[model samples]
Target: MTHPFDLSVVDRWSDERTFDVTPDAVHAYADAVGGPSPVFAVVPAMDLVFAVAETAAPADLRTRVVHGQQDLVLHKPLPVGEKVTVRAAVVGLHGKRSGTTATILVRTRDAVGDPLNEQYVTEFYRGVPTDLSVGVAAPRLPSEPPAGPPSAEAAHHLQHDLPSRYADASGDHNPIHLDDEVARAAGLPGVIVHGLASLAIAARTVLAAAGAEEARLARLSCRFTRPIAPGDTLTTRVWADGAGYRFDGLDGSGATVLGAGVAELRA
Candidate 1:
């Protein structure tokens, strides 16, 4: 069962999309992720993911996709009302025993073409068989976490309504994050929070602990190790790692949900 979508056209660019980082959109994204600093002039980093999600993947490839991992590098803060052009390309495709993984590289720039941010989004299509002969396997994050007591920690409560709200705000209406039946069919215990939502909360916590502004967030990357149920309490733990920070997210029971988290803040 080869994948319905062609995987050989790597590096081919998709049609460019212009995203206006409006105040309303920024506020809505904040509200969706459970309010961060409400008065931020710089847009939330995950908004770039939302913008890419809107136009990155072809429709036929979206029906059964799951966000596997994400890497974001911000060159400059996206100010409200600025229109950024997003150009995406298929950077890599891999065939695994269970499915195919596709990597989308999204480059965001100012109207004058100054680089604003770069995002690498990985999506897994379960049960989509493909030829392993041609595709390369995506790199894996370390399963082991940093040792010692965390230098900083922050607890967050994911409200029961958050998934639906985030779905609306982020334009990610995957039923697995909203409909219980859909989740059950998909083998999830219940509707789960968006992985990017969890990442957002963790990133915000680290920035706050470092006494840094959201605009100072230069790089963030993480792997989702477990599903985050709506209404679960998440505790993010961070440790200083040279010029960057390594972190992880634990559920109420202390089980790791987001792992191998790394973030770099601008000086």
Candidate 2:
């Protein structure tokens, strides 16, 4: 069933949550996705990811859910010392294989109600589904022309906490990415990187793409597409476009891990 929604009501929510921004927090997020370290991005990302899940709608989720895809777009990089409110609405839903798989559309705006970002999140939660035991992506979509070679250097490669250091970085006590026993219970191979952690890397990539010099950079946004495992190597890519630039987060294998990454330039 298509979830018909009033774009207006969703925008003007009866309930709203306020987040006081800290430049440190925003930068930390960006740093995670920027250069790799012990794995800081996962920690910060977990905080936002689950919170966003709740904010989107409690009634729409289930205990068996998994994050299939997530993305963040930005009119501006979330600056420090700004209090922003994320107004999220379920804009669309569709069933491809009779509820075996689907997409959840959500858009979050800044405190003043300006469009901060749009997310095209797809969740696959159903049975009799196609086999994906290998965690390899299934093929779909028409082929597009190859992208031009990236003009910018990789600039940064970051590694957040391995399974060991995640706790100290982001306060996410999620056992799936840290504790081996807990990961077993969750049926995970081992510790996985936090989704937000990966997003943080992407954010930093955007900033770099805008310009390595802090003075020349503008705003940034990202959309999280897939999860980054703890041992994975994160590669940042940027292209020098017109006013700003385009940036993205990629795993070591040269895969497009996140889709719809954006960044703007300063005057």
Best by lDDT: 1
lDDT of each: 0.74, 0.48
| Model 1 poorest ten-residue lDDT run | 37-46
Assess the local accuracy of residue 42 in candidate 1 as a C-alpha lDDT between 0 and 100.
24
Q: Candidate 2 residues 9-68, lDDT tens each?
A: 222322355666666655554443444322221222334444444443334333324455
Q: State which candidate has the highest TM-score.
A: 1
Candidate 2 segments exceeding 4 Å error: 1-14, 23-64, 77-79, 98-122, 126-146, 155-175, 181-187, 212-226, 240-249, 253-256, 259-267
Q: Name the runs in model 1 displaced over 4 angstroms.
A: 1-5, 37-64, 129-143
Give per-model TM-scores.
Answer: 0.85, 0.59
- For model 2, where is the 10-residue window of minimal lDDT? 133-142
